[model samples]
Target: MALAGKAAVVIWNDVTPEARSDFLAWHGREHVPERVSIAGFRRGRRGRAVSGGPEFFTLYEVENEAFLGGAYLRRLNDPTPWTRRVMPAFRQASRALCRVEFSLGAGVGGFVATAVLPELADADGAFRSALQRTAEALFAAQSALTGLHLLRCDANASREKTAEHGLRRETPELPAGVLLAEAGDAAPLADVVAGFSEKMASETGRRFEAGRIAIYRLELCLAAGEVLPPWDGSPTFAGEGD
Candidate 1:
């Protein structure tokens, strides 16, 4: 499919384990399919914490900004007790999304997907710091990145199940290379990957593995309430307004 405009990557961090179960069940059961029903939406993918995230990371993509800003907002404000409870309890450390001004090459597609982040000498802090530096560099370089999200997984157990989640099955391998980036075109993206590989090799004194990693894209679907799609690998949307 041609690249859609106005894509977004949302990172949601759970305040507690109790919240994690609710969030995942809700998204899989109610939210995703709802978003898919909306007009103008094309395809959407959901990602779980294969490597790094706040317990979990869900990516949404849509065709228009209004669904995210207006329609989505309204759903969050719905006064129904169920809506009220799920809406307010959620916490966000950071949320970022942007339009696709330019890009080349299609999203990596396969049964297993892995992203290799630099193996920091300081495993705890190095990955996070490198991620931040990369994001800043991309923005400063006038890259086409529209969104940014950084998360620390709540537990290693969660990473194994990332692919079982509906959206994550697209790439089902352990991560090695960068998870996210902005590209102006195919040439720039190629340059970025080459430079990134070189930088990692020099810093860690080892060449980063490629077959273990893959490129993946995201989409958001928003529709009125409905039964969410099954985890058969189909894309969906759930309406959490605004």
Candidate 2:
């Protein structure tokens, strides 16, 4: 199980309950396609919280950190009318552009348990070393864990340009580090991650605040050449050409 790509861009947000349906429609029909069509994008996956935390999550795998500033930013700057309409409806949006430091897994799964840890004052070398050690320990403990990826936020690559489109909820502060573990079932994986968190804290004397773990069920996943269901009766945007 090698890493999927050099970097991953993650977006987590809560959509107003009233806008949930349309939000999902736009994401599946327009957003995912538009992103994956970009040259460096490998895949795009979206998930919804099955347990606790934000209602929506999206992950985009890109060739490298440079892709964030290249093709990706160009799209972000030019929003479709539908994108313009849907952007403002997102609440508590948090975006992160991350460098994929380590990954261990054979394949993706139906569910993912993610742990977002706050930044520490430690130097980059020490911080990455600690995360690697913890991730290795977790992998050794659970065989069903299909993927364990550690992402370090690349602050310069993160942006909130959507604000210009009137979708201006303050971006949540980026996590210093993110851990994503995939599994067939959410419940058991959640428990495993919890225990792993405890072990990491106890051994290292570092406290990752509780309630930061979220479990999500895969909702939409797309890659190049996949046919997207027609956006029947959905709102249209002028010049929506991908």
Find the candidate with the highest TM-score and give its number.
2
Taking all chains together, each candidate's TM-score versus the true structure is 0.44, 0.85
RMSD of each: 13.2, 5.0
Cα lDDT, model 2, residue 176: 82
| TM-score between candidate 1 and the true structure | 0.44
Which portions of model 2 miss their true places by more than 4 Å? 1-3, 120-130, 160-166, 199-211, 234-242
CA shift of 72, model 1, Å: 3.1
Residue 65, model 2: lDDT of 80
Candidate 1 lDDT (Cα, 0 to 1): 0.41
RMSD of 2: 5.0
> In model 1, what is the error at residue 45, expressed in angstroms?
2.4
Flag regions of model 1 displaced more than 4 Å.
Answer: 1-3, 79-83, 87-92, 107-242
lDDT of 2 at 81: 82
